[model samples]
Target chain A: MIRLHLPQPLSAGAALVPSLDQSRYLTQVMRLKLGDAVLVFNGQDGEWRCVLSDILKKGVVLKAEAQVRPQTIGPDVHLLMAVVKKSAMEFAVEKATELGVRHIRPMLTARTQGHHLRLDRLDAIAIESAEQTGRMDLPVIDDPAKLADVLEGWDPGRRLMFCDETGGAPVVKALSALEDSGRPWAILIGPEGGFSPQERERLRALPFTTAVSLGPRVLRADTAAVAALTLWQAAVGDWER
Target chain B: MIRLHLPQPLSAGAALVPSLDQSRYLTQVMRLKLGDAVLVFNGQDGEWRCVLSDILKKGVVLKAEAQVRPQTIGPDVHLLMAVVKKSAMEFAVEKATELGVRHIRPMLTARTQGHHLRLDRLDAIAIESAEQTGRMDLPVIDDPAKLADVLEGWDPGRRLMFCDETGGAPVVKALSALEDSGRPWAILIGPEGGFSPQERERLRALPFTTAVSLGPRVLRADTAAVAALTLWQAAVGDWER
Candidate 1:
């Protein structure tokens, strides 16, 4: 069951109060009434089983029964993709979150040819994805920034696995070199038009960047982002651990 | 540049003869005349560079210059996803093809809901994806079959890494264990409603089945299919090799 957003803190030993917005969804949308059960989870606390107590004009009330599972951190893997079309970008973010990305950085590259991103709409999609996927914590969605700036300010500690559209070293070579090293890493993917010659050169020259190929095929930006992340996680992230 | 379908083989010193359809695309749509360069590739032969010779109503002619890279097979991986909605299913297939899946098997489960499938359209998507990705071979698309039939006639040599929605062992565990043998493998992912209890039980009983979890999240059927395939390829296929 999906968790509803409640206004106030869920008291451990007190009555459970679902927000008015959620109350309407529960009563009107879901047709769930008093005495009906629902799963509740605050991003702060563990998931809970709540029973409806009173359906008030303002909202509805419930009493917490027990905790299902506590909120835990997912992988340290982050995905940084050059902003593509709105639909593809949204799909990439949702899939990245589901694949256990802790941070999503939508970078703007020289070749990026997309419109303004609706941050609120993107956030809602992420939230709904998290709720549906049973993810306790939603990924941190960072503001979009220029690729050059993001690279210039990059820390040396985090390994940057750049998904080279030109098809460089086999992904296995890059991934195997990082195995057994407990290091935080991120995957970089290009937009639809792909990286310009200068941008590609700059990325390839970065000391922290490790260029990798996603096989022989040219994947769309969204697909590349997800595939690169999946490869990273399986090769070196918590999947191997 | 996306590879264009040209007549004749793509071998060195071979004369190209574009059919009427390709001639129209080159003359009318692309507005390319004589002496314009284009990239062409045959599934068996490597990609090639050719210069347009003549633009005739009957056909277009071109002469091959030099051979590109030799044809190389993609990652030795296959995907089996329960049939989903039309768009979602198409998205999954396109992404899978871009991610270098060698084969795609669509299945129908007991709890499967959606039914509309446009096989021809999906095939076109795969062809376009391959042409865009510079793939020398197209991934085989299989017709939808009953889940029980797929399992009962399972090959003993091939391992089936089933994505269990109920949360079994993390994907990494099963992948690591399988990596040692380096055997051929396929990933089985269920639909939105997931497998029925009996379906799950029968799957668990299969000697070739290894249930793996796609983390703690409940990803959609399409996302789960891609994630499972990526993880499998990384753990035991070309990524590790």
Candidate 2:
């Protein structure tokens, strides 16, 4: 069954209007006809089984038949990644969504290259990944912010898993030490050029930040995100279940 | 420091010549003058510090100064991934190299999309990733082979970690049980359409194969490769070192 992420509230027998793009996908691309069954969900509501009710000039309406699954969120893992190239940044967002990240915060560090990021495009990628990956909720993509500012407003209660390239304890060891903490966590990945001296010092000095190395190799920013997230999931997240 | 993957043996005071593309990257892209220092490595030999010795029209010559690091190989993990789309397949090769897979064998399955893969392109991607990620060696990219043939000729001593979409034991749990068995391993990732019913049944019935689920959500082939490799590394590979 095709899964669609609709923002509108859903309930049994509720008529929901899909977006223009989604309408084209359903009517033209997928060739789904009236009364065809489709799965739909909003971030707030659980997944629902719906049937195509009517076709309009601009869009189509879907009628929710029954709630198939209750809403559930994954671990509170935020990705504080530095802004990389456009392709790499987009790739990070898509993979993070599939890996069950809750939030993506693009950080602007001293070594980060200057580039304009289209938040709408990133949001679209996140939604598509979530829909395809059987995720019940979409990750919140935040606008790019300065790394200093993000750290300044950080919650001390949340442990920060900093992926340092220079040298640090291995990720498995670092995560093993935190196995009993049970605190919410976020992962920080630097840009291709890596973190500047000041940025590295600041991150290391933070009380809540724990520096962890992915391995001996220096992975690209996008690969680091996936590897770090995978380690987190295996060690502390829901992968144990 | 710039890193180059050279196939020639390296030693103190050994003179070497680079390929045409590498010369272009050094002269035009990086704008390096003669006598500039760069790091060079071959799969068999350790990394060496070298200096530009000569500049030709098509290639450049370098003189090795000393061995910087000794050759080291990662775990004996082979990736037997079904051939996916061109971009996704290339991405998997790159990430697998960065994540320290010793070998990559592209497999053809019933549900795999038909496409021509340029082995040269994949080798280049692997070399570039290894060069950038501090890897001492490059992974061998095998020609696409039938999944059945690969499985039939498989070594019974090596365990096969199968990422099954239908469901199985969680990855961490499955890997934990293999902690005592120090055998070589291979990971099998299916295509985007997933494994055929026959393929799934055959894989599950194999005694050497251990089916593992990444998580609750379904991951794209590329993400699955990264996540699966990361999990394996954390549980039993060199990350524990």
Candidate 3:
């Protein structure tokens, strides 16, 4: 069954008025007709079985039938990545959602080139990726902020996994050492030019920061994010469950 | 320094003439002049510093300098993946090279969509990735073969890590169990449509095959390839070193 991410509260017998965009996706793209079943999730009320109840010129309406799955979220893994090129940034967001990241924080570092990002565009990408990857919840994409400011008001309780391209302790070992801490974690990936010297020093000096190396060969910023998340999952995230 | 992948054996004091494409890239695109320094690597001879000795109309001549780094290869990890669509297949090849795959064997499964692949195109992607990722060696792309034929001649000494989208043992757990064995390893990732029932049965029943789960979510074929490679590296590949 096709899955859709509905933002409104879901309940049994509630009518879901999909937006024009979604209606075109369902009616025109997917060719779904009235009475066709689809799975719907509101990221709060869990997943529900729904059917197209009405089709109109402007949009389509769905009637929720029954709740299929209880609401659940993945581990508290937040991705704090430096703003990269447009295409790479989009790729990162899509893959992060599939890997079950709970939040995505785009940071502006000294070497970050582009500063502008359409939040709506990223939100759409996240929603589509979640729907396709069977994720019940969507990752919150925070507005882009300066890395220094974000770190200044940081919660010390949450561990920061800094992916240092200049080489550090192996990621598995660094993450394994934190296995007993039981703290929420975030991964920070630098830009293509990599973290500036001052930024690296500040991160390395922080008590909450654990600098981890992805591997011997240098990886592009996007690849580093994926590799780091995978290592984290295998070491201390939900993959162990 | 610009890096180029030269297939010929390289040695100090040898005059190296680049291909027309590489000459255009060096002279026209990069605007490199005679006497400009570049790094060249052939899978066998490690990396060497080369100086542009002559700039001709069609090609460029280079003089090999002292070796910069000794030849090194990543862990013996092969990738056996079903041929996917053109773009996704190219993406997989690029990522596999960045992840230090030693060999890539494209297989034709029952559900594989594309039957033909441009080996030269894939080789170019791999070379570019290897050059950018600071890898000394290049992965050999094998001719496409039927999965059954490839399995029939499989070496029992090498272990196969099958990334099954369906539920299976967690990848970390599955890989941890293989820590004691010092045998070579390869990863198998299916196409987007997944393996046919008969194909899955054959894989699952194999004594040397270990079915591993990436996570709970359904990952596209490209994502699965990257995640599996990351898991393998962290568990038993060079990342552990």
Candidate 4:
């Protein structure tokens, strides 16, 4: 069955038209004929079983049959990663999506070098990942913002898992010691050059932040994001059965 | 402060010669003159502080001043990952080395596609990752072998953590439930298309195998490797300080 993350509202008896790109992909690339089964899920609606109803010259229309799965959400975990190079940034976003993060915020640090970040490309990657990973909804990809500004407007209710490289407690020990409340959480990853001294000091002072080191060695930004998410999920998030 | 991974036996007051590639990198690229401090480490020896003693046309010679850090090893964890594409395979190796995996064995499965794997290239990646991540040792990259053969010759004492996508116990719960017997462990990650049914059955029947699911969604081969390592390290490996 072909799974797609569509933006249009999905219902039992509504018609949905795919985008031009999707239309060409379905007709020309995949050669999905009329009446072929296709699973579609809007971010707001549950996953729906649909079939190609009509194939037009420029597009294709789909008719929903039934909802195969209900709307579900994963644990509220966000990733705030300093943007690295183009390839690394995209790779991190895709991995974060697969790891079931709720949101992705591109962070800007003093040593951050990747300035040409695009929101649309990241959204596309998230959508593709969600479709492939069986995720019902897409993670909200926030715009790139300065780390200081993000910290200033932060909510105290959500604890932050700061992946500090210079010095910190071990990941397992620090997270195992934490008391799990029903609050949100986020993981912070710095750039390849790492955070400046001033930024590190400020982050260390945050009350909700729990600075934890991955291990004895240093990791690239993308790898750190994946490792941090894995540890956080296994410790407190949705990795438990 | 530059770090280099040298294969020669390192010791105090020993003159070491670098490869031609390293020679150009140190003299032409890095522009290191005589008496410049350089950190060198062999997989067997502790990290040594070396200084440029002689600049040769073919290679550079360095004198080991002192051992800056003692030789240390992380938890004995091996990664048995099926060969993925070129980029994903290399990325997984790099990440595994940074995560302190002791050895990496490329497993050939029914759906494995990347056949042009070079041992030397993978070794280079491991060495570079070790140098960059401040790791005291490099992971041993084993030759690629059929999954069945490797499992047939496997030692039953060392447990295998299989990342099964179909169904199994959750990662955290499953890993935390295991007894800490100080036995070596290995993580088994399937190919992009996943393990064959026969292979899966064989793995499940093994007495030492503990099949665990990452989450509801499926993950790529590289992502799965990192996640499994993170959880395993946290549960029983050396993540606790």
Candidate 5:
């Protein structure tokens, strides 16, 4: 069954009109006719089974039949990635959603090249990823912010996993050393040029930061994001469950 | 200092010429002058420092200076990935190299879409990644083969990590149960639609296979490849060193 993400509240027997793009996808592209079944989920609501109730000039209307799955969010981890090239940045967002990140923040550091971000475009990608991955909720893509500002406004309660390109403790060992406190966590990945010397020094001096090395090889910014998230989930998050 | 992967042998006082693409990159793109320093590495030889000795109409020549870093190979692991779409296939190759895979074999599974494999293009991506990642060796991209045939001639001595998308033991626990056999290993990732039910049955019944699950989410082939490689490295490979 095809899955679609909707923003409206969902309930049994509710008539919901999909957005323009999604309507075309169901009617023209997928050629789904009236009475065809589809799965729809809003971030707030659980996944629900729906059927095409009407095909009109505006769009296709779906009638919710029953609730299929209750809403369930994954780990409480967040990712703060420095702006990279367009493709790499987009790829990181999609993979982060699939890997169960709750929020993604585009950060700026001293060495990070300034790049314009299209938040709407990233939100669409996240929605599509959530739908495809059977995720009940979407990962929020926060507004781009400078690293200093992000750290300054940081909630000290949330532990941050800093993926330092420079040498640090092994991830498994470092993560294993800290018993799971079930605290909200975040991961920070630097740009391709990496964090400047001053930024690295400050990050290392931070109290809530846990600096760890991914491996010996120099990984791209996007690769580092996925790797760090995987390690965090495996070590202390919900992978074992 | 810029680095390039060259096929020729490297030694002090040996004059070597770069290929046309590399020559353009060095001269036109990077705008290098005579005596510009570059680091070159061949799979067999350790990394060497070289300087542009001459600039000719055809290309620029470099004379090897001295050895910088001794050659060291990462884990003896291989990746046998099902052929995905063009962009995803290329992305997998690049990520596999960056993750320190020793070799990559593109396989045709039951559900795999029959996409033409461009060995040359993938090789170029792998080379560029190796150069960027400071890898001493280049991971060989093998000719495309059928999964059944590849398994028929399988070497039982090497363990196979089958990333079963249809649920298996958690990767951390499964990989940990085996006490670092230090034996050769390979990872098998299925295509987008996942392995056929028959294929899954056959894989799960294999004796030397260790079936593992990445997480609850539906991971794309490329994401699974990176996640599996990272977990294997952290668990048994040389991430600590």
Candidate 6:
């Protein structure tokens, strides 16, 4: 059965009540009919087994049969990347969601470009990726914020593993030093031009930031995002278990 | 200074010889005249500091002044990914080179599309990546070969870690159990549709292979390639040192 993220609260024996948009998708795209089984999950309520109860001209309705799995949170990992070009940024966002990132913060740096992000399209990408990857939750995508503003209000307990383009400590060393603390963490990757001198200085001065090297080579922003996340996942995330 | 690969052996006080293509690049594209300093490196010889000695219509010559760094190989990690679509495959090859992968083997699987890959273009990408990333060594891109053939004639000393999409043993567990005896290793990533059932069974029967899961999500082949390599580097490569 195809999985769909329904907006309404889902409980045992409750009607599915898909929105008009979702109903079109179920009827037209998936060609689902009455009595067809579909897995439905609301971010707040747990996942539920649902059956199409009625198909009307305006919309389709589903009846929740039973609760399949309880709502659960993903690992406390966030992917923070400077807004890259349109195609690359979308690719990074899709991969980050698949890799279990719970939040994606698009950073606006001195050299960052802003007019490319389509918030609605990106949100759809996240939902589709989560559904395909068997993720029960979707990553929250925040509006792009200036780099200085992001660091100014940084959480002290959360460590930001900055992928320093100039190269610094190796990722393994940085991860080992921070893994025991259990701090909610974020990985920051710069844009194509990289951080300006002032931005670099401010980030370096922040107490919660640690500069780390992915390798000797200079990876593209998108590649850096995935590589940094992979390193973090291997070193400190649930992969260890 | 822009670094370019001149795979010929460099000797102390030897005259820098630019090829016909390189001569055009220096004189036309870069607009460099006599006495301009450019960096050059060969895979076998170390990086060299060269000053343009003469500029002619047909050719250009430079004096190799000094050695910047000795030739050294990166971590002996190879990336073997099943060939994907043209653009995605090229992107993987470029990123793999940038991330310090020493060898790239494009595996031809049963379900692989027989799209002709341009070897010359991939080689150029590797060279350009090495030049931009400050890596003295360029990764070697091998001709595409069958996965079963590559695994059948594999070296016994080198370990092969396959990214099993079915999520079996956690990757960290498989990586930790790998004995880092300083032997060359490779990471194998499957195609988008994943390996066929028979192919998976055959892979599992291999004694030198390790099946690892990249968390719960179904990652694209490109993302899985980077994730698997990062895990390997952290667990057993120079990062551990």
lDDT of 4 by residue, A60-146 (tens): 999999999999888999999998998889989999999899999999999998569988999999999899888899999988999
Reference-based lDDT, residue A212, model 1: 84
lDDT of 2 by residue, B8-82 (tens): 989899999989989999989998898999999999889999999899876999999999999998889999989
lDDT by residue (tens digit), candidate 2, A47-144:
99999999999899999999999999999999998999899999999999999999999999998989789999999999999999889999999989
Per candidate, the number of residue pairs that clash is 2, 0, 0, 0, 0, 1
Candidate 1 residue spans exceeding 4 A from truth: A5-8, A12-29, A50-67, A166-183, A193-210, B5-42, B45-70, B167-173, B176-183
Which prediction has the highest DockQ against the true structure? 5
* Candidate number that wins on TM-score, 5 or 6: 5
Total clashing pairs in model 3: 0
Report the alpha-carbon TM-score of model 3 versus the true structure.
0.96
lDDT of 3 by residue, A97-193 (tens): 9998999999999999975798899999999999987899999999999999999999998989998888889777677776643469999999998
User: Candidate 6, fnat value?
Assistant: 0.61
Whole-model lDDT values for every prediction: 0.78, 0.91, 0.89, 0.89, 0.91, 0.82
> Number of clashing pairs, model 6?
1
- Report per-candidate TM-score of chain A alone: 0.90, 0.98, 0.97, 0.97, 0.98, 0.94
Candidate 2 stretches greater than 4 Å from native: A180-182, B180-182
TM for chain B in all models? 0.89, 0.97, 0.97, 0.97, 0.98, 0.93
Worst 10 residues of 3 chain B by lDDT: B174-183
* Candidate 6 per-residue C-alpha lDDT over B205-226 given as tens digits, one digit per residue, 9 for 90 to 100: 8887888888756687877887
Kept native contacts, as fractions per model, are: 0.54, 0.72, 0.62, 0.67, 0.64, 0.61
Error of 6 at A116 (Å): 5.9
Better candidate number, 2 or 5, judged by DockQ: 5
Which docking band does candidate 6 fall into? acceptable
Candidate 5 residue-wise lDDT, A99-139, digit = tens: 99999999988988878889999999999888887888999
DockQ of each candidate, alpha-carbon based: 0.42, 0.69, 0.71, 0.63, 0.74, 0.45
**Where does candidate 6 chain B have its weakest 10-residue lDDT segment?**
B172-181
Tell me the tens digit of each residue's lDDT in model 6 across A1-241. 7889877878767876777888998999999988999998777777788999999888998999987888876679899889998877888888898788989999999989765788898999988878776677889999989888888788898888888887768776678666553559999999988899888888888888888877655678988898888878767887666
Any residue pairs clashing in model 2, and if so which?
none
Candidate 4 chain B weakest lDDT stretch, 10 residues = B172-181
